[model samples]
Target: MGNNKSLRDMQAEVDQYISQFKEGYFSPLAMLARLSEELGELSREVNHFYGEKPKKSSEKENTVEEELADMLFVVICFANSLNIDLQKAHDAVMHKFNTRDKDRWTRIGEEGEDENGNN
Candidate 1:
């Protein structure tokens, strides 16, 4: 809809995570650090799950919420910077998926599977 997203939009996208954050709940710098931390955690989890990295002692302990929060915070921030509504954007994407992919991907899972019940 616009040429490019703005910094304020990014900030708002991220800030949307804190539904009731107080004035002192966080600072810009803190949010940046938290985002990086969450991204790192997610990367580590992915490596443990599907990459070559061996699992850490706490590897099984997934910080899914932390990662989600971090992602949403940045997303809201980005959206706010560009005056984009996440709810609307998300809905649009879902609508597209529902209409276009419902049938396209429905049978993709069997592409690699054997046919006629043969292995």
Candidate 2:
């Protein structure tokens, strides 16, 4: 963890990087495809590290953290291209989870509740 940066900062950084290129950001469809590709890479890394799937000796070495960062970069680019504020989107998602999904799960050290709202 180097210097902590906000989502806005990350978005700006990506925008600046894309600005230098003649072809700024990819189209939404292309970005989505790229996102899916990154996701697949991340999933493969996770499977190699945690799941039963093991990497072959000839395969190139990679870490889950690196794959996650790659995914984040693509996500930031996608968000920036759409002019969507990730921080605001995150806040809204958090709000929904906090309110609508509150009590949806059991708390540690506390008795679990059933769907009927029983103890």
Candidate 3:
């Protein structure tokens, strides 16, 4: 079964998987380091695609999607270790953005739109 799991399901799955291991989850500091490393990998991929840096001939090909998934896996592990529900966290952040930044940016109709209302 793929592509059917929600954020909580994914967290539970990761927790279950890690439960089988003797070591379980890494320490919080170690998890943070792993997250940083994964982020760096993503940044490197982005730099290769959009920045001046070029990938070495010997470097293996990596996609942004793959790196993002890797990062998400680590994030799931972190959240599982801390008993944090990512869905709730996501909702809280969304709420904050919706309320706090609601008027932060200019609305499309505010400045007026093009002939077809395509601003």
Q: Which number leads on TM-score? A: 2
TM-score of each: 0.48, 0.90, 0.87
Worst 10 residues of 2 by lDDT: 108-117
Task: Report every candidate's CA lDDT.
Answer: 0.62, 0.93, 0.92
Q: What is the lDDT of residue 83 in candidate 2?
A: 95
Off by more than 4 A, model 3: 112-119
Using TM-score as the yardstick, the better of models 1 and 2 is: 2
Give the winner by lDDT: 1 or 2.
Answer: 2
Clashing pairs in 3: none
Candidate 2 local lDDT, 5-96, one digit each (tens): 89988888889999999999999999999999999999999999999999999999999999999999999999999999999999999999
Candidate 3: 10-residue stretch with minimal lDDT: 109-118
Write one digit per residue (lDDT tens) for candidate 1, span 22-79: 6523456665776687788778767766889877675357755666766766656545
- Candidate 3 to truth, TM: 0.87
Give the runs in model 2 whose Cα sits over 4 Å from its true position: 113-119
What's model 3's overall lDDT?
0.92
